[model samples]
Target: MAASSQGPVNGVGEDKTSVRRQSEANRKLKYISLAVLVVQNASLILSIRYVRTLPGERFFTTSAVVMAEVLKVLTCLLIILLQKRGSLRAFIKLLYDSIFVQYLDTLKLAVPSLIYTLQNNLQYVAISNLPAATFQVTYQLKILTTALFSVLMLRKSLSRVQWVSLVLLFAGVAIVQVEQEGKQKETTVSSGSQNYAKGLVAVVVSCLSSGFAGVYFEKILKGSSASVWMRNVQLGIFGTFLGLLGLWWNDGPAIAEKGFLFGYTPMVWGVIFNQAFGGLLVAVVVKYADNILKGFATSFSIVVSTVTSVYLFGFHVDLLFTLGAGLVIGAVYMYSLPKAASPSSSSSSSSSSSTVSSSSSAHSRSHLSNSDADSETDAFLPKSVLVK
Candidate 1:
């Protein structure tokens, strides 16, 4: 009897040790993912802003978008291949099965893929014209759009706080737009084809597309059994085709005269790689981070971008822009807060508790799925790293 008791105690101690190790591992992942996220978010915007503002032969934004798509597809395929234990045969079969065998399901992704491609192109248009700091602040409107679409498309209910946050988000973006418009008129000198009005329209439309595509993607994800990387592989395929079509339509004449890769430079290549890597980073963050943490990363990134912009681009942040940016940052944090669980009545407390426990288990299983759906909507933009 004494021996049996000791065995059980030793087993309990081992279990505790295992749990502690797991906890420590998770904590490490969370912080590391957060740091990477903050850096990726800031760098992508700054790089894009820097590249677009450089005076000289500019790389074609349409071609850059297409190349980014190509790189993304390759990256996703590599990931899926690794998941299949580096078996090329297995990877090819899986891709063929998922992409070709399941034709209808693959076709469904075409919708979000097209929208994402358009959203990505709009990103260059917006950033080229708007200041990086201004674009970052204004781009948070995607959250408002996402929330609205979540309600309409997914029939998801929002809390009172979330609704109030959305209103504040809109107000903040409006204030920033007003300030930008005023600045556009006040400046007499030409700022190298910078058009605040065009940027404003582009960003607003991008936000709308971001929201719809994100929610639509999420809705479809809920019904499917595919992995996130596999879905991305599908998106990359569609995005590449759509991006090329766009390139032909917008820059056909220019490309014919100067080649598809005209004006390519080392800086241009860095930007393309950064954009592609940002898309992959979103999946990592979604895996290791939660909504609240992701929101904090985003808010911190805005501050970093704004401060960097002031030093790098001599960006002047007036009082109005400051206040507006503050509001947007706050709204983002508020919106990410989880809805408080309602308390159960005393009479049925035990039963309610049991039900809640079971439901929470199910929710945890689906948590990653929900986060992935949300991330892709902003993947190329910034919400994900920006476009994610």
Candidate 2:
């Protein structure tokens, strides 16, 4: 009896140790991912703005989109291969099974992939036409759209606070637009051909597409056992094909004259890699951190972009822009806050509260188990609200 008691005590102690270690590891990862996300979000936009604004031969945006897709595909493939412990046979078989054997499922990604590709192209258009700071502030529209779609498609419940946040977000963007229009009129001659109207339209459309594609991708992920990287590979495949088609349609003549990489420069290459890396970084951030932290990173990124724009592009932020940006940032943080436990759920478990508590404790200990890793796909999607 003494020996058995000691054995049980030892097991309990070990479990506690394991849980503690896992928690610490996750905490570190959460912060690291958050940091990287802030940098990536800011840098990608700034770099794109820099490249597009340069006065030399402009690189073909369509070709850049296609190249981004190709690089994304290759990067995802390499990650999957590494996951298979460098086993080439295993990697090939897994790809064949996921991409070929499961052809129907693979085809489902085509819709979102196409939308994503278009959204990517539109981003270039928007950035070229608008100031980096304004674009960043306006791009938060994706969060509002994502929440709306989540309610409609996923039937996800949003707290009252979240609803209010959405309203504030829209109002903020509208204010920014109003101010931007005024500013554009003043600087029209000085600002060259930058078109506020064109950029506004492109960004709005991009936000819509982003919202739909992200939710659609999340729906596919929830019902499947495939890893996020695998789905990315699937999306990448379709994206590459769609991107090439877009390239042919939009920039075929230009490419024929100047070659595929016509105005390619080192900075252009950097932007491509930055875009690709940012896409993959989203997966890691989603895996380690929740949407709330991601929102904080986004909020920080906006601030970074705004500050950088001031120095680099001589962006002038006035009272309206500041007020509007502040509201948007606040909305982002509020929207990301976790919904409080519903009274119904609380009441339902009231009778067995003690039992529930014990079970929760047990779950806490086992939450970092392999099963949790397998279910990572549920959080892997590029969700602006839940997964982003």
Candidate 3:
């Protein structure tokens, strides 16, 4: 009789142990995902900076953008293949069905995708002409532009703190840009000012493209039920088409003179691969993590990039640049603060607990689907980096 009574307690103990183990495993997976995202972002910036140092490369922007898009498509296909249980035929069928069912929705993102292609090319230009640290700091202007676009396109209201953060973001970028200008004036290198001016133009255009593409993509994602991989595939296809057009427009004469892929090197390939894979990692992070974490990742990446730039390229960081970067990082942290729930909303949620429970159940199921997809993708990563 005592043994029978102890049996139920033993089963309960085992169940608790299992739950504790599962929770620990999940925590590890989240940390692994965050680490991968941080590494990817840092590598992306470093690789671009490395590419700019390669000698005798001409018209690398067009070729790198094209190759990156092609790689993105391939990565998307790989994700689809894994998600479809490794059945290429099934994957193709799903692709066909999705095209038919969501073609219009995909088409809606075409313009933004093209804009992204432009932004990609401009990024190369800016990195080539500007110091990597300066470029990274100045690039924070995209956050401001993204906020503006979110307000205008998504009709989202920003809190006063967010608006102040935007203002701080602008001030930080201006400080960095001014520091660059002052350094340019101090240097006697011929065409230094001209190159700096050109880089500024590229950065501004890239910021606008990033802002618009981000808002447009968010709109599409909200309005559609397609998975993140499917949307990325659609964007990749459009980006590749637009990249080809851009190549023809900008590099036609150069291509005719030197032929395609004339300036290819291992470093260029590194840049292309980093660009493509970094994008996929970012999408994964966004799917699995909250915006606050994503913002933290970005801010962390800037710090890593800046430090690596100094050691790898012998880049110098001055007081003004340090101050500006501090301001930018502070602004990012400020923007990432979670909004407080209103009392009315809290009371309503408490009153409608049953309805909320049902909705939460559906949300949990949806979240599980996303997590499964992420897990499948993680299989392609290193064994040490498994999501779960």
Error of 3 at 373 (Å): 11
Evaluated at residue 26, the lDDT of candidate 3 is 56
Rank the candidate models, highest TM-score first: 1, 2, 3
Residue 280 alpha-carbon offset, candidate 1, angstroms:
1.0
List candidate 2 segments past 4 Å from native.
Answer: 1-24, 339-388
Q: Provide the lDDT at 16 for model 2.
A: 68
- Per-prediction TM-score, please? 0.88, 0.86, 0.83
Candidate 1 minimal-lDDT segment of 10 residues? 339-348
Model 3 residue 218 lDDT score: 69
- Per-residue CA lDDT of model 3 for 71-114, tens digit only, reads 88898889889999999899989898777666787788788778
Every candidate's lDDT: 0.80, 0.80, 0.71
Q: Which candidate's TM-score is highest?
A: 1
Question: Over the stretch 274-309, how does candidate 2's per-residue lDDT look in tens digits?
Answer: 787675776566666666787798899999999999
Local error of candidate 1 at residue 301 (angstroms) = 0.5
Which is superior by TM-score, 1 or 2? 1
* Cα distance off (Å), candidate 1, residue 309: 0.4
